[model samples]
Target: MRERNVVSAQTQLLSTVAPSQSPSFDPDLGVITPPSNGMARSAFARPVAPRARWRRRYLACLVLIDFVTALGASRTVVALLDEADAGFWDQRVLGGAVSAFALVTNLVVPLMWMTVLVAAGAYDRRALGRGTEELKRVARANVAMAATVSFLALGFKKDLSRATVAAIILTLLLYTLVTRALARVVLRRIRRVSQRASQKVLLVGRLSDAMAVHEVVTRNPGAGLRPIAIHLPHHPRPGERVTAPVPVYVGWDLVPLVQQLGADTIAVCGPASLESYELRKLAWQLEGTGLDLVVVPQVTDVTGPRIHVRPIEGLPLLNVEEPTISGLSLLVKSMLDRVTALVGLVLLSPLLVGIAVAIKLTDPGPVMFRQTRIGHEGRAFKVWKFRTMYTDAEQRLEALRHRNESDGLLFKIKDDPRVTPIGRHLRGLSLDELPQLINVLKGEMSLVGPRPLPTEDDDYRGDVRRRLLVRPGITGLWQISGRSDLTWEDAVRLDLHYVDNWSLVYDLGILWRTASVVLARRGAY
Candidate 1:
């Protein structure tokens, strides 16, 4: 496993590419480097640098984490080794049997387990880069290993204590499950902490198709794609954002397309979805070019759990499962939210009071800030929060616009004068957003959904704005990923994704993710 040399000292990021370094056409491949040492080589080079080395490092880190957890958990079995239960007696008897078993089991099981991952095609370089999918793979691999080991032990008449074995199994499984997930999440933030993940890829389709692909990928920055140019077999319609800012090329321009864009991947999701022959040719052209050819299917709002890709005789088949949401399922969410939110409100009441008091003392203002944010079906209602700004912050908004750094309808600044001293701390760790439990109680909001947006122009927001289809939440996908630091486009994308894929099980995951995000606070500002 390659480890990205983590730069230990605090340092500021410098731009890797010059402003004028724009490629002549969108990249067919090779624009972003693997995240290296968390350093931006572009900061010093000609805007283009070899970065496969960086990817190697990031992948190595993930492998190292999984290895440590599995190896470390194996050591914990030493504790259960203490002074002996039956079937597994003294050091020599137990030791010999267990040690022999351990050696065989450990060696065979891990490899077998890892083999399952390989069989499942779980450890593909690209798949491992994405967090959620990799998590499922890790869990699946561990479960398979446990089953195999248990069966083997039983057959050999050397079965250890069920409790000890179970503990060992649980520890091994949990460690892999957790550490793999952690490593993926942490690597993303740490690796891309300083530099943006900008992939140079070529768009293969009509103008509308190219534009749609660009929009979708842009909305998911964590996906790590940056289309530098476009490829059109023929002229696309005028007024289509076919080449917005990025250059577009014709079929005859393949050589320039590769050279000018420094493209590392050819993203085919356009009319080519209908063009098998050209798609094949495009794949052939990209071969040996060190550029990946990725074909994006029409699948949307679907997670790995519901989608299975199988290849039979070189024909790839994609299977999308029907949604599991049912009436009883929704009830699970409502009940869970109500119980959890209610208990949380009561348990954290003292902390809430402390926040309110601090806010009042800092700004001589209402301890709670209330503002109408759009909720389900565009219902307007005030969401509550411990005051994180001066009482006059809104009234003084006009003056702060010049300082606004957030790129979207939302306003955000890392160090806003409007934020009280206490507010900054609350905002950092997210204590400031706690008062929305009241909104949940009132049925004006949900315990989890998109962050409700505030609007005043219309009688009610529209469905495009209808993200209000679900009740708003106190913390959500947006909150966990980044509160204010996210681009406006990404904020809505997550909200819509959440709305499209809402489930009780999904909500539980969101809440868990929210805890980790809070501690890391990568996007707090």
Candidate 2:
């Protein structure tokens, strides 16, 4: 009877506590989770997932492992530099002709070591995920760090032979890249196993808001959150916990129920007095006792770069800024678009001609295909491509609409019948998009931007239309990120991320990566 009375009272208190702040605004909007139901109505659109949160212990462990591994790798490189008699190791060795230590206690080596780690972002919690990009980042950071060390060594001391440094650099680069890749694979595997043993969390919040958080953690299961309870703050009392018999006492005896349940995490859905200082104090009281407190909002697909946290009058104020492509930098972007596109068109003219001939022979179509697509400012422009389909491809589109495998407003079929034999080959090699260079030169497109959607007026939400802020790209963050394999939201997020953080350095990086991705053919079809 006492337990029942307590439960009834707790439910009544929860029913009355008002949730604070806006219910729908996303703090960051680029990294949200996609809808699991899978149909997308827009070419480029933000996700429904919250930005990922990670376990501090796991992150700290990964960082420590990476740091030690890097130090050891650095030491091995240094030892090799010492052992190589051909002035390779001897020069870079502490007392040798190539040493950076002539100035201090291997200060340069240590600085190089730290810089390499930092540049690789091995310390970042987000990079713990097993992905090609994470490994690439680590490899790039190590290479850049070693290169900095070698170049600085050479510049400071003329007696230093570049050959020794070069050899050591190449050897270390290969070793480090391979080593990091293997380590990530293993760590991720181990993390997966550990995730299976993760403590289950029961969350209660607004239906839509809670659903977003649920999907986010569920999608990235390795993050170690297994949500088992879902109480709707709007509903006051939840039916029951999903995986365990945990009682969630909201408002009244909330602290006591949390204590009794021995929950590892309590992710309150909305900001109520229950989620305020008292909740934080509850978190503090439970800290050493092993319970984690989490508060997730409806922030969808937002990245940290887009969300700025400011301190105003003792409150944690959030500033969500609008991103745009402007200033003199657009000039640089334009210049790069023109130069790369012109060079691409010039070098590929022979191949283009060959493809054109093949398409003509096979499909009996015009040498070029032009389609109207939405561009920067939502303006319509004709996008050009080497004709890789029958001239009547548009007329046959209706039959393939249902066959569209792409999960968005975009239409694509893995074995599209409209693709002539030659066209399929060209698309596989990304050669069909070659004529887009002319569009770049004509100011209707760029070498990189969000993939443009056709201008036939497919309906889109206001959030989905933001990709039009920049000219459509022949190849872009989306193209290199996954191309056809990317979900609609991923494509949109990558596009928006690029637009928000446009930089000349990033463009050059993308171009360089684009070459590798083309050769690798990660998402051609």
Candidate 3:
């Protein structure tokens, strides 16, 4: 009777708590369970089964789309081959034997392409909403498929148009990537409307650790894991309510709780909270349940490519590969940066001239803004920008310091008196930074890298100074993420992430996202 009274009172308190704050609850150790029916429409509950079915059907549609895309690509390639190499087709008529073989090859190519996609796990539900990794897997599968097809033809001594096959595979790869990108955009919109489609997660950890992981997951909705409930087996204050947005459950029996909540994922944050025996028991209980067990390491800012899990003697050991700091690849990146900058300057000369003319006519000051900035290896360089502030803006900075909106090491104000009338619009669209293309050409920066800090503000130490290993960029991860809207810690984390994992493909992805962010004018000044 006492235990029942405790459960009832805790449930009542939870019901009264505001939705914005985390709920606090008293631990109920006895058989005083929450009402089963109430679990269906709790603030965190959703129709999990229906959403799962819908996703399966959605993935099926994507598979059909890929199948059609492969067929179309093959036929298009054959037609191009016909036009480019007419003699090859002409030779087919000699007994019509070659023509029959050509027809067979065309039909087989698309089928093979579909098989490769399936083998790649491109249509897997888990891979659907997650970013880049899905696309990278698709690329890898197509490349491997192409190589396999080539080897088979060589080994069998089969006569075939290798160029046409290569072209078709390339087209298929591109089509798959483009369609998947569109699907992700649509999926995000659907997820916003039908939250049930998001991966439901059961968070099991300390209150502090749960909250930290919660912040990351909530911030990146595109990453797809949604915490529906939190399990604080070791809540510091048993009788005190924990402040959380989701339902707070006390004690661990994670398997039973997960089954009751219909959670698709169980996220265990931090290593210290769970014992080896408990984790092993939980893993055994989770077998055949179809629930994904995600153990999030305390280490932050690590990406998928760096992390590898190797199983030895029934134990999974995680290996994090160290990033290479220098190589011939860096030389190639530099060459490409200079070439791209040279081309951009020549093409945008008229726009640059117009901006200079506008600045001269609008404000009686120099058309360019040159400031000393810390670059590679902490070297100082005079970075150039299209002037967007009044001449006395520097002198006016001290008075507006109190009104700064940014946090931790950065100063930003939504509305600053120092900005000239014309400057506001320019900064809004990021046109003020166009002059930095010259910096790229001058070898002080790359086309894509960490954002450079002002020389006067440089106080980097230890790991923070790693950003100086490569040339700073005109635009980068920080630019696309939030610009002036991001906190100082977030900016540092992103810069450090880039420093640890810099690749040409990553640079291109950043450049692509930069275009979208710029056009949307999101998180701009």
User: In candidate 3, what are the lDDT values of residues 252-286, reduced to their tens digit?
Assistant: 35665666566778898888758877787666666
What residue pairs are clashing in model 3? 22-243, 22-244, 23-244, 24-241, 24-242, 25-241
- lDDT per model vs. reference: 0.65, 0.62, 0.78
Task: Give the Cα error of residue 105 in candidate 3, in Å.
Answer: 6.9
Ranking 1 against 3 by TM-score, winner? 3
Candidate 1 lDDT over 84-174, as tens digits, reads 4444335546466666666744565455555666765566766765766776766677677677777877899774668866776778777
What TM-score would candidate 1 get against the native? 0.71
lDDT of 2 by residue, 1-525 (tens): 544543444344344333431112111211111123423233233222222233455556555555455455456655665576466544446466444444332344444555676767865544655455566676777678666766776788746546645654565456556666665556555557776434456575554455567776776565556775455443233443212122232222333333333345667765542446655554555534445567664454554456778998867676776664787888878987898778988998898788777777776648888888888887788989888777778899987788888876777778888777777778887988888889998889988777888855445457677788777887788888678888887777788777776667667668767987888877886
Candidate 2 has what TM-score?
0.62
Q: Pick the winner on TM-score between candidates 1 and 2.
A: 1
